[model samples]
Target chain A: MQASEFSRWTEENAVYAVPKTIIRVGQGERSTAIEGAVTEDFLIRTLKDLIEQGR
Target chain B: MSPLSDRDRQTLREMFRDLKYPVHLQLFVEDGNQGSDNAKVLVREVVRVMPDLLRLDVFERSRDSLLAALYGVWEVPTLILCDQKREDSGIRFIGLPSGYEFAALIEALLDVSQNRIRLSEKSLNFIRNVEDDIILDVFVAPT
Candidate 1:
């Protein structure tokens, strides 16, 4: 989105500032599933941590 | 390098007039990194467009690691959008917000100025009554 354009994720009364992650790093889709390299798996684990803390 | 053109600056100044509150741009920079260096310049230029509504603060971990750690920042060129009191809004750009990310940064500035998050009633009720520290890490890249 352009800075001049309105934000789709933003609302008049509320701002949804959720963290966003890139899907693909390079050409092929070889994410660091087991370890951590700022991929989808890592993000899920981070979300899981939040859920775990809630429990 | 000056990242913003005079025309862009002018346009941004007009856009910033709509800011209802001040938004602080807290930049965590690394000394020797190329991307960090570029991001610093970019952030400075943007902050200049709205001096009344935005302030720029740059920090180095070598001297201010505690502040960075407090924000959960472990990377160079982490641009955090803070509210009037300089509170973290959990809205951050982890790299140089050049290109498309620049729009995100500008929007973030507006969002932070408001210092509000609109949630569903269910979620808002949960957060309003529940007591727990929340940590969210959003990852993005520049192309």
Candidate 2:
């Protein structure tokens, strides 16, 4: 999906990069994001941290 | 005329050869939306190449309001990939999957068709144990 086509989403999410990844927890009320490509370990760790924080 | 080249179709056929299960693609579209139209064409062409492995169902957003809401689809040109049981895999491409995003779409289809998630055992375990809903919205550009 191209960010240009989703202008509103890009603007709201601040998607200024190629691979901006948003980790949205639950109904998108709480979330975290990464601006670039990340390793599986890093992503998993981030997810774990977010899960812990939410808990 | 097809948007994909003959070579592209051949490559997709080869890539889809390993698909052992069914992948259902639910595409939500609205009339007169250029992005929606493009997504419809691209998705149909991609699924055409792998009919044995892929199932595509196109829907009008306004006409299928209940289904759209059920699937949590609130946008035009939202392509949702599902497993054999028609269960959503949480993989969605919100616009036409073009350029680099096209490759990601192919990979996602393959993954869903094969029921394969390329995460480590520990990561998989953690995900499986998590009770809360997790959504990964990957924002990408054509370049």
Who wins the lDDT comparison? Answer: 2
Candidate 1 residue runs with Cα over 4 Å from true position: A1-55, B129-143
Q: TM-score for all predictions?
A: 0.66, 0.82
- CAPRI quality level assigned to candidate 1 from its DockQ score: incorrect
List of clashing residue pairs for candidate 2 = none
Give lDDT tens digits, candidate 2, residues B25-90: 999999999989888898999999978779999999999999999988887889999999999998
Residue B87 deviation, candidate 2, in Å?
1.6
- Model 2 / residue B103 / CA error / Å: 1.3
What shift in Å separates residue B78 of candidate 2 from its native position after superposition? 1.1
> Residue A20's C-alpha lDDT in candidate 1?
44
lDDT of each: 0.68, 0.87
